[model samples]
Target: MTQTKRRWRVSPATIAPVLIISWAVTSAIATGFNFRPLVLLELQTQALFFRLRGEVAPPPELVILAIDDDSLTRGRDAKELKELASIRSWPWRRTAYAEAIDKIMAAGARSVAVDVLWDLPSERPADDQRLQQTLKRYAGRVTLAAIHATSESIGGGLDQLVYPDPMFQVDPKAIGLINYSPEPDGQLRRFASVYLNQIDADLRQSKSDLLSFDEASLQTSKLPFNAPKGDYIFFYGGSNTFAIVPFWTVLYPQNWERLKQEQIFKDKIVLIGPTAAFLQDIHPTPFGDLSGIEVHANAIATLLEDRAIAEVMPDPAWRGFYLFLALAGIGLAIGQVSKRTTPRFVLAIVIAGGWWLVGYASFVYGGLILPVAAPFLAISLSGLFYLSTGAANDQLEKLRLRRTLERYVAKPIVKEILSQPEDFQALLQGRKLNAAVLFCDIRGFTTLSYKLPPETLVSLLNTYLNAMVEAVAAASGTIDKFIGDAVMAEFGSPVSYGEETDAMNAIRAALGMRQALAALRSQWQQEGKTLLYHGIGISYGEVIAGNIGSLRRLEYTVIGDTVNVASRVEGLTKSFWTDILITDALYQRVQEHVEVVFVGEHLLRGREDSPSRLYSLIGLKGEAPTLYHQVHEELRRYLGYIEATES
Candidate 1:
């Protein structure tokens, strides 16, 4: 027997490590290299967390004094409201803001942060002095907005710091930078308490470290605020989450009684900034676009409520910890499970959903933000890897089975069995089918074995069996088994073309074996080796065909009177001096396609009363005349022996 070639197999032990390593490398690229797309994806997933959480109530202590279109346009045409009419257009007179501050302070507000920048003094000196005096009155309780301009030089460092006019800077702690730093994707999610700059003293003296407007307001309000140096702002909701009062409402005399009655600003931190569309103060947020004033309000509220979301550390060790958790999750999901695609896929989906739930719960209940995108991707990629490899493995397994089956069965039969596995499996369990069984054995094998050495005998037997197997295989017959020098084959088993086709193929295979034996005889005469001859007997009937034997060793073969009768018929070939014989059942099916002579009914060895009718197979009906003549002459040489046996 030829050795089968070794094939490469993908085992779980190999697949598991490869999956883990692939995940690790991908995570490293996402974290260590700061893969921009993945980072953006992570941001989007975090936004989903916010949506899942829905709207939350903001702190009542935070208020947004919006300088809206109503505040800017309502009093424009009101002739009785002369002060408001005079300040309808932007760059309103400083006295208008001064009056609003006095009213809010009198209303018992804790602190006020103005988000409007005041880098240059107004054209009217009296108006500037009026606002300056009001700011000095509540210096420690008020905060003014400033801005940092990036230099046009290389690296885009902070070039200059623009503060409120000198007259309006009543207290050093009153000035704070109102710069909003949005993420690369243009969403403002984080807040910085202080912004440090490197610049000369001449441009701005002793002001290298600037506080954010929200932080400055907290300090001025005397609130005990301690937070991370830099962190994410857990937004309460979208626009208008904080209570908003139009800027003009606080300054309008007609609303004064209502404001004082409502006490809307009582001990509250008020952020005053432009909120009108033309003001260009709209900024993107997790929930949606929010006015700058509302953004600051949310920031201050986050600090007051200690609702800052802390991110998992980004160090290698911390990232590895997260990766480990992801691998562990995937392993638990699919490890040691069946190699079925559906089950593995379902488990993977469950694992991903569970991880998302964990992340959302962490954010909602613990004020922590876990990495969602990278780990989720890891699970998905691993699932796809396993599914793809699993499919490949299935194909490989089928190939292995086909190769093994081909060793004993014909290639065509093996292919048919594999192609329709369900039907073949049913056949293996057992089935009754009309089929043709062929049994062929060497004539006088015992005498031949005695005359030759063991090696020569074995070689000659192998050559003869090889020729017999090829003939059967050519006729689409499965080589059932080989008993030493004999070959057993079956047609129309496991699969069938038709009854007539199977009978014709069996007769064709027997004739082919005779021709093969004649060629071997010529070859042996030239090689000075012993000649060999084979006798074939074919029977057609309903037989139980199936894989029969112990669990460890099973054989696909037929077991019935048909098989036994076929063997007994082959034993009579030598007695009758014939090469091929067939029972009447098979001859009736193939009689139109073959030429045969009826060999009168005779009781087989086991059947004492009932005898089987048989025929001597000569040649096919459509063969050349010369071929038929040659076969006729061959049978004529045995005529005398057959007549003498009858006598």
Candidate 2:
């Protein structure tokens, strides 16, 4: 025989699923590439980012010098002058500041930037000249500190004390206006960088008369010391200025001799700022409390090491393109893979989790922010779209299954089947779950229907069917199907479990159904309705449980010889004068668990040679022994006869 090749036929519905999946997952893949959150975090973290990024800043050359409390106190103790009232008459006196100043000069220091301001004439004029004399001697090397603000009101003090020296002239080589004015919070976030030097350095050039500049002759001849690199670390509240040199260090004999000789004043740059009471110049910085000189030291370090703690974000035009491209790509990936219905949800969860990991890693290690909000948005939107379609198709499959179950089983049974979605799917895939099945039918439905109008017969049948289904449901037995007027049920079907399980549950559900039917039958008789008795048959065995049909159609039902045998056993209820008949296999399992009367053997369908013994399940526990024993003896005798005959 020649084999025929199968061709796939596509319909609008068929292609619709594929298209939807493509569109959905594509949105997810596109959203991930936009790294925007880098800007959202705190600035300190941003500072850390640059620190870790290793971007270098150009070095700046500057230093600080401060006049402190010891000078003032020593002058006072010597009775040099009587406070601010007698400015000119104050007698001069030398203190620790003068001694340290001499040592710093001997240290090969480059430039001394004095950040101290002489707001007023010192209480001791003689003592003040000694300090000014020290500044004047190194006038070429010293950069005098002055208060440069919109208010130049507090003047003359520095000019008179330092600038008015008769022994030496104020060197034009000195830099002027050294204070780094900060914002009210004193946060040195931005470099004082570019603007202030125009005013301050301009003033210094004009006053100092220092020149390397060509007037109108040679087009260019500017001085070498002109360019000021703005890179400087701001140490707000520590000893960057005064060197603290501790009052105690100066008092030490070894250091005192060096201080007197001005040995600390070599080529090193010296910074001086407050580190004592009365002269408060402290502020908080990264490494803790610092003073102005310490700030200068930090600034010097930053410049030297080429360190910048901030990043200027890329322009909007590029940012927009990046975001758009990332989102678009993610969307494409999501849409492409979404066609696999069942796995789509699993894939979405995996995508979301994986994206988080990547984003976190990028942020922590690479100092780069991944576009999480957008990418996640795309994934979620795409996943939701894919999910909706999947759910719709799933529901459609469910409806098909319910229709099939309805044909064979009752409403309650159909509802029970629907309750567990996984179980229902397993049924479609053919899983033998632990479930209880009940098979029921009218006692003389065939004969009774023959005598009555067909319409009236169906009505009566529907009533009994309704009652029996309710009885099985009440006992937790799932009605598998109804063949003509006969019903089939089982102990376990939908859920598969260990061996001893389905047997006991099946017996319980069967016993409960018997009780339920008994009451229903009695009520029907009392009402004068077309009275009918029902026979129930139950079996416990592995069977394929699932939706049975093509893609266009499907039905959830159980199939196997166990289910067939249960039906055959139910059919034999007529041969024996009994309302309920169960096989020996079922009886052996539930014997010790429920109250059942073993009926004598009967020829079960599909088993002509061997007669199967039947049982009437009454209820649970030790309720009715006499009835049970009688039925048991009859079953024993009949089964013995069959066994002997078979041998």
- The lDDT of each candidate is 0.78, 0.51
Q: For residues 115-145, what per-residue lDDT tens digits would candidate 1 score against the true structure?
A: 8887898888898888888898998898998
TM-scores of all candidate predictions against the true structure? 0.67, 0.51
Residue-wise C-alpha lDDT for candidate 2, range 1-647, written one tens digit per residue: 99978778653335444554454334333223322342233334433433443433223333334434654454445453333222122222333445455656655566555445454455566756776677666656654444344433555433221232332235444433334544323444433342234345655555543221111001111113222222234222234332344333343456557654754544445555555445566655544455554555555444334342322223534444555555445544665675555566567657866775666555444435444544455555555655676676567657866776665544665676787746245565766553445567665455566677989888777776776666555544556666788766654555433444566656655555555655665787798866555556766555767767786656557787677777777666545545456667766776776765677777666777887777776656767655434433544554444356556
How many steric clashes between backbone atoms does each model show? Answer: 0, 94
TM-score for model 2? Answer: 0.51
| Candidate 1 Cα outliers beyond 4 Å, as residue runs | 1-20, 151-158, 194-205, 320-325, 328-336, 407-647
Best by TM-score: 1
Candidate of highest lDDT: 1
Worst lDDT 10-window in candidate 1: 192-201
lDDT of model number 1? 0.78
lDDT score, residue 580, model 2? 56
